[model samples]
Target: MILVTGATGHLGRAVLDTLLQHTAAHQLAALVRDPAKATDLQARGVSLRVGSYTDPASLAAAMPGIDTVLLISGGGDDDGLQQHQNVIDAARQAGVRRVAYTSRALQDPGTLANELMVRHFQTEDYLKASGLGYILFRNILYMDTLPLFTGPTVLETGINLPGGEGQVSYALRSEMGEAIANVLLQDFTDSRIYHFTGAAAYSFHDVAAALALASGRPVVYHDVAPEVLAARMRERGVPEVAIGRTIGFMTDIKHGQESLVSSDLAAALGRQPTGLLEGIKQLYQL
Candidate 1:
């Protein structure tokens, strides 16, 4: 069976559903922390394996008969290092042949995203060191979160940040889901890594324009100093760690650090991902 950790999460759920449609639900296992949350998935014929990264015993039990394993990084914390290590260790002990891990695109993200990226790097390192056949899929920033980034302003004019007109290729969650399904089914004779991204990059100015058009509202793009922006967030009671990292990340984008689109994902999946405008149009119901 193919087991998916964090199966209850957004990306995981998306991946799971797509996997179900593409293959047999009976052959899939969803490893989750809460059984109640998985009632629907279970009733739909998925095997629900109760597990958590913090609980090594639970993790081992989940992997006992599983074939391919998708180790999605743990949720919402610096705790990923420990949790992922536990999961990987358990997988090793259980003799799972191969592991597919999801990681972040920007390793040195100066944004609030770094906490998890750091852990993703660590988990990936552990998997490599453990001498197992592994697949590293580095996911880019989710295009779905763009709406969240502009939430308050979205209700009126849409929020704007100092994105320096930098172009970043971001993919929709569905495309990511489809690509992951492709990866899970593909032959992996050699150790491989794929950087999953969208078909093209759009500047934040471009994003502002598209969002405005999509929502039928005027959006503004205000470029400010990274430190100044962070200071304002700090004054708004944003945590210090997140503030520093977010600002640093903005600086990186401002300088075009992650401005390019990638073909690696398409090569891996044998399919092209959706473009930004198309995803935005669909998501916003525009």
Candidate 2:
């Protein structure tokens, strides 16, 4: 039996939908915090179990009769390291044979990074010590977030951020979900790590060029100082924490922390991953 946590989320739902193509719904289980939101899954014969990473008993309650678990990492209000540890410990007590984790790509453990990444590295270390067979899917930044970095009138405003000449191998969230499902469907005895990323890396300037081509309008990439960007965001009423996170992400990109390309995603899906220009064009609805 296979159990997937965060089964109602965007990537989680996409993964469940893809997993259904390869296996029966009766063989699947979902760990959801809110049972009300998972009615559709229940109607489809998916076993719905109530659980929260903050609640260890709930996690243990959800793990029975499950052989493999797909643990989708999460962070918001709760300490991510503790939350993942809760799941790992519960899985251990439940005697789950294997665990598949969704992790971020291009993070250096030695260097001081973002708070989000620090928590991820901590979770990875804990999972490594758990003594369970695991598959680490180190996913890249999502391509859907490109439009968020670009303003509403991106065609006119172009791309403005603190990053300079940094490249990111952004992959589509849905595509990555399919890749995860493919991995879950396969059989493996040894623990492994896969870098699920785009086929090519693109800098913000390259993104602006892609936007220009897609929209048939002149677009430019402007590199701004972190303090200046934060000040502008503050003036625009962005929360201090949100501003800090944005700056941290841009700083990481500027330092070449997310510039990585891998064929693992394509190999998993048995097809070429989506191209940068195509993904950008779709984001713009062009």
Question: Judged by TM-score, which candidate is best?
Answer: 2
Total backbone clashes of candidate 1, pairs 3 or more residues apart or in separate chains: 6
What does candidate 2's lDDT look like per residue over 95-188, in tens digits? 9998889988975745634666777767778888999988899999899888877768878777789888889999999999999999899887
Summarize candidate 1's per-residue lDDT along 90-193 as a digit string, tens digits. Answer: 88889988888998766344443234356677788899998778988888778887765454445364444556777678888767877887789876667788
Give model 2's TM-score versus the native structure: 0.97
Give one clash count per candidate, in the order shown: 6, 0
Model 2 deviation from native, Cα RMSD in Å: 1.2
Q: Estimate each model's TM-score.
A: 0.88, 0.97
List lDDT for all candidates, in order.
0.77, 0.89
